[model samples]
Target: MSLLQRLIARPPPPRTAARVAVATELPGGDEVDVLWVRDPRARRLRLLVSERGARLTVPLRASQREAQQFLDVNLPWLAAQLARRAARDVRPAFGRGDPGPLPLRGQLRPLEWREARLLRIEERDGSIVIQAPPAASDAMVRRALRDFYIAQARRDVGRWLPAYMPGLPRAPRSVRFRPLSSLWGSLSPSDAVSLDLALVLGPPAAFEYVLVHELCHLIHPNHSRAFWREVELRCPQWRALRAWFRGDGLALKAEMKRLVGP
Candidate 1:
């Protein structure tokens, strides 16, 4: 190694694990640990590194050599992730207004608001509609929508749980709402359901569809044929409804953000 290289002490290159391992390179140092896992059912190699650590989730067929190559190629990405985590760890505040434009459903939109009671929805005869109170500023409107989704989840999630899952013998232990980036709702195996607050700002039908989808999970955890059949039983045209949600209902989140300003 050159004098500069030796003095700088380039962290050792990541090493590949054994063939039995899913395939990923070893982390350079203890500052950030790495894990490799092979999933027979996985279609492709995927990497997930968060505040906790880095891990490789890849197809079982991937060889250790391939895993190591993948890790080497993604070294810069992994290092950047570590840096981001380090930065976030020192973040100063929480619950800041306008968490900067967040994605509601699929569209990215700005969230702005003030305090008000009226809940209004506006759309220019298109896929996305803005839901907020006229007097309520953008921030307040988002807050209202957030509150609305939470209240609705409490009422809606439990109603369908027992109906769809008769074997449960009792109502779901708890139902709650939070901001979820990707899904409208999720059902936990432990009888808990979490609703995404963004849903409250979505169309009424979207809310219903989400309610139906999540409740079905109480009985069927996986997206198996039986699970879809259950969803169909509740909303015969659920497929079409979901399509509408993807195309239209999902955009309400963006609409709300844009129309409601800081």
Candidate 2:
């Protein structure tokens, strides 16, 4: 290996001093402030951009020069992403007692709130009615609401998974759902499939499409051409659904975070 690379890879001696903060100038002349972190478990440098800001994590004892170089290379791409996020209109986050229609099942369903002895979420007359005590805490309401969303997501998975099982070599070891920041679905090395629970709030077709896509992974674990062909054969509308996500994925995730995430 090259001497510089070897120097960056080696662990620092005990009692080494912490490095200064890393910041770089964006093309528009604003400074992109980075939260630099050294992680012992990290295998390579990773950049995370979120509502909070940018975070750069590097392998323990990696040289600041290497980290800075990495950040420099990724700056343009980061700038573009930040620009997209900045340009999109910002929607206010959902909060308790807002009584606004919710983004549900590809439609904005009217949401009605009422006082009851206990918290409950029910669907009726093409809308959702939620009941809670006269003084329910926001945390309590959010928790109950998140549970409701999870149950709904599972119902869709239960309905669609059986149909896709026929031609596949075997069923997944397990199927699970949860909130994922950046992925719609993932297949673990153990063949378990986990999907983002937020999908239940979108169109049913998108939910079913994601289910089929993950089930296809039981046969081909990687995204080789053969794998995509299998996907197309199973779900003919896969491409359109993919395009749908490209257009609406960010908003959907943002909605999920607002409604259910802590």
Candidate 3:
């Protein structure tokens, strides 16, 4: 690099005058550079990186050294995760062409646009179908399916709770929706089951497997042999479904993200 080229290189922005250590090493074994992003509305530190640079946006109340140390310890894990994410990358299958028909619960269903007020499921000439009314936009279709699936999931779970665990108290009384980036669902001790809305777009088998797994938790809170035995008894194909989800979860999650907007 010539001295003239160095002199012509851009200088740091004023907001990032204070330097911080970055969380990852670059491809050439160089430590990545960090830029401080301060926003008064920020309530915590947010670290993000891109080809341009690594950025650490911090709240006014944050302890810079503490945040840096935390990132340092987690750097390798973060890098590995990011690498995996980069490897399993996907692009939106929407607008390019029809994603064509999708299978739901062992039935082939086509997604169609119609001008109607309600999102509905109906059987048509020996085929089960999901339809969005003509006024329905992609966002509406996505949201309606999410709501329908979660509600149906709640009812389905409610029905099995009693049959599986006779005389069990409360019967898994409440089912709730939540966004979980890691797992599909969770069952709290208070009879509340939190389901990931993202699972609605997964393969039908994966969706059912997760629902059954969480519902089984109402009886066995821990993943004990008895709990798994219960899962196997209720969902015989669970192992295969689990393996499928493991391979496809990232792709499904990416689709969900696109539907909801990244």
Candidate 4:
């Protein structure tokens, strides 16, 4: 084919729309940025709020004016959600001269910074003490804090996993921890289990319930009656735990994210 014909036959690149964001003020005078997103798959206008801010998604068929009206109508709802977050937004600003009362293993512990030969953390007398160099940066402190939390979480899992192991079909190939946005715990197809690190910031009972729940998945992968029965066999108080999580889990996740940064 001629070069011109070949050029003509080539399909055009997909159109990409630039992201749009607008600022809106709350009733209490707090200004928030709302990102306007256009999605073809969205059937109607939707507003999503988080500690970061708000996002307004619009269907392809909707106009910007319609979207703005929808946002105005939902501003009150957003305000209420933000208020709830404010109550839970208690994680301290680290690295500053200010000491903290950070959440740890289901309770709030006072945070203290001290100068020591090594940059490390130690919990004693119901307080979290970080011994850092006189000139250590905030990022260094945050890393030490993150590592401290992970180590503590691993300690909990180690203590609890063996209890659930003998009854399971087999041991998990592996287990991992991270900041999961939507799930408390998950069992991979290979029988590996992954859990949210924020569980360490909640009640120990809730954390163990998640471990028990995932370990049972090795024998029954689906949430059928049999799986629930197995879960009950391992975790008798799971019903109460579920109710507690429904009330506090998401807020715990947001709190953890804020503490650790992103």
lDDT against the true structure, each candidate: 0.54, 0.76, 0.58, 0.78
Who is ahead in lDDT, 3 or 4? Answer: 4
Candidate 2 residue-wise lDDT, 157-262, digit = tens: 8888788889899889988888777678999989899998889889999988888888888888767788889999988999999878755766677678778664
The per-residue C-alpha lDDT of model 4 at residue 9 equals: 38
True-vs-predicted CA distance for residue 206, candidate 1, Å: 2.7
Clashing pairs in 3: 114-133, 114-134, 115-134, 116-134
Residue range 32-149, candidate 1, lDDT tens digits: 4566655554556766553235677655466655756787888777776656555545533213244544433344445443333556433232232334445545455555445543
Per-residue alpha-carbon lDDT of candidate 3 for residues 1-262, written as tens digits (9 for 90 to 100): 5322222233234444334443456443646555555544455676554323456665555554655665676566445545655654564533212454543343446655344456765435544345655665666655655555556555555654566555343466677765566567888868777877666555656777887788778767777788888789878999999877655565555555554443
Q: TM-scores of all models?
A: 0.43, 0.70, 0.51, 0.68
Candidate 3 structure lDDT: 0.58
Clashing pairs counted in every model: 10, 0, 4, 0
Worst 10 residues of 1 by lDDT: 4-13
**RMSD of candidates 1 onward, in order:** 11.3, 6.6, 11.3, 9.1
RMSD of 4: 9.1
Ranking by TM-score: 2, 4, 3, 1
